[model samples]
Target: MTTITAGRLREAAELLGIRNQATLNEIRARYSERVKEWHPDVSQNDPAESHEMTIRLKEAYDLLTDYCMNRPVSFRLEDLEKDLEQSPADYWMERFGDDPIWG
Candidate 1:
C-alpha cells in the first residue's frame, strides 16, 4: 500500500493523457504504448535519452496505476478542469500584472 499525493497523481495523468475521466484500462494501455515507444532497446540505442524516458514513463505509469486502483468512481473531473483554467490566469497575472490578455 503505497501512499500517493494528489499532485503526483495529477502529474502522472497529465503525462499519460488521462484527462476528463479516462478509464483505468486507457491509462494502462497508453502507458504501455508509451513505454514501448520510449524503451531503451527500441529508442535507437541512445542510453541517456532512453534512461530518462524510461524513468519518466515508469513514474507516470506507477502513479496512474496506483490512482486508478485506489480512487473511487465518484472522482470528479470538473474540479481539475476549473483549477487548470484558473491557474493559467493567475500565473499570467502574477508574471505581468494588468496585462491585456486578461481582456
Candidate 2:
C-alpha cells in the first residue's frame, strides 16, 4: 500500500485553500476554480507559470480525491443528525470523558 503521509495531506489541503474537514463536492468545486484560474490557455499568467500552477492544482486535487475515496463515509439520517447535534460541550466531553473533572 502507498503511504499517505500527514504532511502530504496537509500540503494538498493548503494548496486547495480548504480546511481538513471539507466535503468531496467542496474539494471538486475548489479544484475547478483553481484549474480555471491557472490553466495554461486560460490564465493571464505566463504560460509556463500557468502550466506549473495547473500541475500543482491537479496534484492537490488528486491527492485529496484519492484520500477521500479510501475513507469511509456515512450518509444515514441518524448519523447526519448525530454529527449536527454535537455541541462544543459534547465534543469536549467525548475527548475528556474518562477524566474525573471533565466527566
Candidate 3:
C-alpha cells in the first residue's frame, strides 16, 4: 500500500489549482478544465509538455478522488474484486438475508 503524505496531498491540490476544502464537484471541474488546456490533442504547443501536464493532472484527480471517497490513494478495483470473490457465498447470503429486496 502506498502512503499519502500531507505533502503529496498539497502537491496534488496545487497541481489541480484547488484547496483541500474543495468539493468533489469542484475538483472534477478543475480537473476537466486543466485537462482541456493541457491535452495533447487540444494544445498546439510542446507535445512533451502537454503530455506531461496531462499525466500530472490525471494523477492529481485520482489522488483527490480517492481522498474524497475515503479510500486509500493506492486502492485498486481489482483488489476489491479479488476480496469479494474470496468471500464465501454464505457471507452475501447473510448480509442480504434480512433485506426484503433480496427476497
| Best-matching candidate per TM-score | 2
Which residue pairs collide in model 1, if any? none
Residue 75's lDDT in candidate 3: 48
lDDT of 2: 0.90
Off by over 4 Å in 2: 74-81, 87-103
Query: Residue by residue across 27-99, what tens digits does model 1's lDDT show?
Result: 8888888888888888876889888988998888887777678666543698667656767667767767776
Lowest summed lDDT across 10 adjacent residues in model 3 is found at: 83-92
Among all candidates shown, the one with the greatest lDDT: 2
Better of 2 and 3 by lDDT: 2
Q: For model 3, name the residue pairs that clash.
A: none
Q: Quick one: RMSD of model 3?
A: 11.7
What is the lDDT, from 0 to 100, of the residue 72 in candidate 3?
A: 50
Instruction: Report the poorest 10 consecutive residues by lDDT, candidate 2.
Output: 88-97
The lDDT values for all models are 0.77, 0.90, 0.86
Off by over 4 Å in 1: 1-3, 73-103
Show where candidate 3 strays beyond 4 Å: 71-103
Estimated TM-score for each candidate: 0.59, 0.70, 0.64
